[model samples]
Target: MKISAAGPDVDMIRVDAERLHNMVSGHAFYSELPKDVRGKIGKRKAPHYLRSQEERNVASSINHDYYNSATMFLSQYVHTLPFALSQLSLTHAGDSGALQLVSMPLQYSMPFMAKAIAGIETLWPDMRLEMPEDVRNLADTWDLLAEQGVKGVGT
Candidate 1:
């Protein structure tokens, strides 16, 4: 998200948004702003990536649904401390045990990795990048297993 936000896109670096970034990234100065202006800004989601062509194209691609759903799901486990703590109860420590704790985040991160690769391929088509066979095999295995009502963990 930060990568796309910090990209060379003009709209991504809008004056108002840069001002907001400057305000937050420096001293805690939000209170210095007028109450009405602060309220309006606080009520909205900032740095809206949908305004960017790259993000819009990726959002409209084959990975659209999974991208949004997984991002929302994973973002909770990531950014919100209380929600992440609450989800610890859902962690199944099987034979792999505590390693599941580490692996689970990496598993959820796969979609982001895929999105990055897709972006690279889109931006540099001459590079003719290809998904590694093992990655493709795992995706196929996941789809096949999902059809059988299996989550494909440890499979």
Candidate 2:
């Protein structure tokens, strides 16, 4: 729980676990609850527009704090103009940097998978015991994948 930044910035502040815990404890605001009880902020009404400032701020804050914030209805990149212009994602050939219809050699997917495994292990210790046999087997395959040095797969 360390924050290190370089700048002459006067407003720069650092937060540790305890500080954050205090900030968001039982004292924190609840959207459903009245603003007075919830630290006296906004009005007690839903936004007229889906992309309103309040909506955007809440969406961004949730995405920042939570690890798995993906939802079917929401796009985190909706506010970014260039991202929409790029049409989600663009895959280019490695050699000539040519735009390829084929998405080849999914690079570093294994690292992300490993991180997902670690996240699950941390969040739910009994997950392996409760998991289905086939799912467990699939998870076990990661060890073999690591041994083979499949891109970004490592112990």
Best by TM-score: 1
CA lDDT scores, all candidates in order: 0.57, 0.42
Distance from true location, Cα of 130 in model 2, Å:
2.7
Best by lDDT: 1
For model 2, residues 105-135, the per-residue Cα lDDT tens digits are 2222332354467557878987745568786
lDDT of prediction 1: 0.57
Model 1 poorest ten-residue lDDT run: 144-153
lDDT of 1 by residue, 1-155 (tens): 34545546667558778786567645576677556655556655444332354457444443444445556767877687677676676666664556766576676665455556656777899996566999777755544332222333346
**Candidate 2, residue 29: lDDT:** 44
